[model samples]
Target: MSAFSKALRTLSAMAIALAIGVAASFTPAHADPNATLDRIKSSGVLKVPVMVGEEPGYVKDPATGNWSGFYMDWANDIAGFLGVKVQPVETTWGNLAADFQANKIDIAFGLNPNPKRGLVVDYLSVPLFTDAWAIVTKKGYEKKTWAELNDPSVRIVVQKGGTMQVVAEAMTPKAQIIPVEDRPLGVMELQANRADVMILAIFDAVQVSKQIDGQIILPKPMLINPATIGVKREDGNEGYENWLTNWINYQRSLGLAQGKLHQTFEKAGIDLSMLPPEFSF
Candidate 1:
């Protein structure tokens, strides 16, 4: 071959190699799982966020590190249906919103879907359970209703960055509101008499009442809250949300939630009658 032709051939080969390298570099690092359902199917595990608390209808285990609760069982059932192992990540309500936003957790249990929350994360269609605000106070000081708790001298302890804070501020503008780090701490504040009352979920209030010498009073009118699952708001995860929504709806339709609630309350040694009549799963 001529020297010019030989040089041309070598340059062409080099250009082809560079083009291949560039194409490979442009390729996606990972395939879109398309939904949480597909991702779990691929990974063989469902990652769910279990909020750490002693709330009766949520997560609590008196026994040796065994994770057991109403939401836990419900999550396990979903995992079973998906043919995936259940993996629970202990989280806090204060951080759950941020965690979901960061995609650190796939699903958040016992979440009450709110319009403001919908902007940050996607919620399942089915509400697993419903709870209401309960005012917990020392025995003789039990307020009959939210209105009674709204007195200017009434000090209310509420968890920081939680629904209770929003609810309390809206209902009791005149009352002194103290923000605690978490639900348990807010209950502790009330126990210590640092606050006149604590506004929390009825289930949680009942659980705390069992542990402390307090009276839990459900107002004549309850601030009803519907609890659902929270999933990450990602295009790739939309399918998963839909799958979860459908699956949860199926469970609800079959009255599985009622059984789950009974089991949870029984395990917690809580009498269902103690809860307000309106509270239902």
Candidate 2:
């Protein structure tokens, strides 16, 4: 071929390659339509809001005000996936629903799913962990069975607007249910002997008992609660939600979730034997 013809052919090949690159930029094979993930990536930070004081899951150390625990580890993995830094936002259990509604935070952990919450936020399709609600009380006030807590004399303290309150009511319809602002306060009431019982998750029951000298966790649990994280309900983020659900399952598959719980139990000086069989590491 003539030199001019050869040069024209080479120019044509270059144009085709440039066109393909442009097209890929607009519609790459892996392009995700999840606005949530897009936001996290662009911002370079995954904001994970959690209850401030819950131990073995989400704890803000009093000594240094640094955050640690199960959620912290999970947040790091999520941030790694997003290629961003994890920013921990402090929140209260009573305020999580409202905070999520206001878009004050992007993620919330250790929250159980319910209809009312479903309206405002979406839960991971796969549960991150399974836990049971237990009743804590003065050592002498321990109930022998779940039925014993149904008596009219039983006054159970629960965190206001928390799922434990709903469980407490369902388990002991005739008993009085008192709402407290947070878990720490609920345990404080029990410690003072002003409250006869306080209902919480098994881990929470253990955490609360640590605050008071003689509180006992009933041998039997009041209810089983499967736990998952929460993200705001945004329209066009279904792919992002599915990705997160899968990520959680991967964590469970690798024993990362269970391992975090085990680490927490060990740090708290609690034996894994006390946890249910399914919770065994």
Candidate 3:
């Protein structure tokens, strides 16, 4: 080889080695991959945040102040594995990232993942399940199809700071999108006839139907989203993320996901007309 060519090759080799050295320095030789796991173990408290306002998936009982729902049960199951007492905290569909940022909670119980949400938190690689969004309205209301709800006169209630807001705006471009702080408040709007409809998951809408006299979640959902547990982005240490991810896999291996879905469905009294097939297996 020419002298110039040999010199260029030498320089490239040095650069590559320097880059590898810098990357190696980022992770100290003695750093622990299970730091988060060890910390939670020592604390003996796993502070889990659940959506107190969203039912059939996560909610706090008004009478007992105890939390129960699909996600709450899942969190309890996780706490069992970690050998820690679950400290259930009340959270809403929105403000998950804010609570995580403030270090007030370790994880959120139930919610779907989106690109916008992905920017703030890290979700498990294996999704817990798929949730399809549908139209919920009064029993006698005539707006059946998604197309019918696309008029400016249609009042669509959406949970603020959640993906439902984006879904409602996109589905009904000309309709009035009324934002509420929580799912129950949105259901209340529909119950009082203050709002024409609210777009939400069948699981949640079913729970709300029991609370309202005449509201019904129609079949034919428009949006399907994958739901999972979320951890703070920066706090997604291998110890924390890996344990949760593997737990999801382990639960599915035991065929618990399907059974859990059915149990919640039974509790919500929601039929399987438009529910996704993945809900079963």
Candidate 4:
């Protein structure tokens, strides 16, 4: 072949390679859409995370090694619907995403859907419940609005490394944010009078206030946050998420979720009247 003809052939080969690379770049990452559902059906168990020592949501009987709480009740309900047994996996909120990614658990409830965590797991659109940010305060420290509490002199105790901490930092930036490892430690801060305020979800605030004989205040212009379910972000997760959202909607419509919440609060010795008049499940 002539030199020009050979050069032309080479150019055609390069163009074809470039076109193939472009096509490959536009292709989506492969995922199994029905992977989670199929696994659950085959295994005959729905793996769910159950927090140890967490009341209202999860409680364990040391004597019988059995779990009972609103969360377990809901888990059992979901499993029953799927014709499977619920296998509880003890985990913490911070470790849930990791557990889901590692395939250690199949689903987690009561997760606050946030951007950072959304990258790792899929959250259902239907919320498990709506909870407002509230503060449990001593007798004379009631503040009507969040802005009123944003002062350097005001000391706020929040659960370390949780959403409460984030809210305290953002909403009460000028205030003192003391982060504790858990709820009990936060309660200790209040009881010892070391902290003037404790930030928590409204449901938690009511119970804690009753426990400590404090007062619950849902700051004005209430900050409403919804808790939802999180599942692993795997191929074929659409069906799983859809089914979960539908189930949640059905439960909410029938007042089953709210009924469970009421049962939990009552079992925890919390009076329904303690909740703010404006608050609803």
| Best candidate, TM-score | 4
Q: Backbone clashes in each candidate structure, one number apiece?
A: 1, 0, 0, 4
Best by lDDT: 4
- The candidate 2 region of ten consecutive residues with least summed lDDT is 272-281
TM-score of candidate 4 on Cα atoms, chains taken together: 0.85
What is the C-alpha local distance difference test score of each model? 0.76, 0.78, 0.76, 0.85
Task: Give per-residue CA lDDT, model 4, range 1-281, as digits (tens).
Answer: 99999999999999999999999999997767676788888899999887763666788899998898887898899899889999989777667777888888988888775676778889898898888888998777757788999999899998766778888888999999998777778898999999999998887787688878989888988888898888998878888888889999998899888888988888888877878898876
lDDT of 1 by residue, 67-127 (tens): 7677777778888887888777777776776887776777877777556667778877768
Q: Each candidate's TM vs. the true structure? A: 0.80, 0.82, 0.80, 0.85
lDDT against true structure, model 1: 0.76
Q: Which of 2 and 4 is ahead in TM-score? A: 4
lDDT by residue (tens digit), candidate 2, 1-281: 99999999999999999999999889936444587788778998888776755887887878997788878888888889889988877777767778878878788877886777788888887778877777777667657566888889888899988888787777788988889888878877877767888888777877776667545454454356788888888765777788889988898899888888878778888766754454322
Tens-digit per-residue lDDT, 145-259, candidate 3: 6778889998999999888898877778899999999887887898788998888766676666666754554434445666678887763267889889988888778879767
Question: Which portions of model 4 miss their true places by more than 4 Å?
Answer: 1-30
* Model 3: lowest-lDDT 10 consecutive positions: 272-281
Error of 3 at 174 (Å): 1.4
Q: Which rank order by lDDT, best down to worst?
A: 4, 2, 1, 3
Stretches of candidate 3 exceeding 4 Å from the true structure:
1-31, 213-221, 268-281
Off by over 4 Å in 2: 1-32, 214-222, 276-281
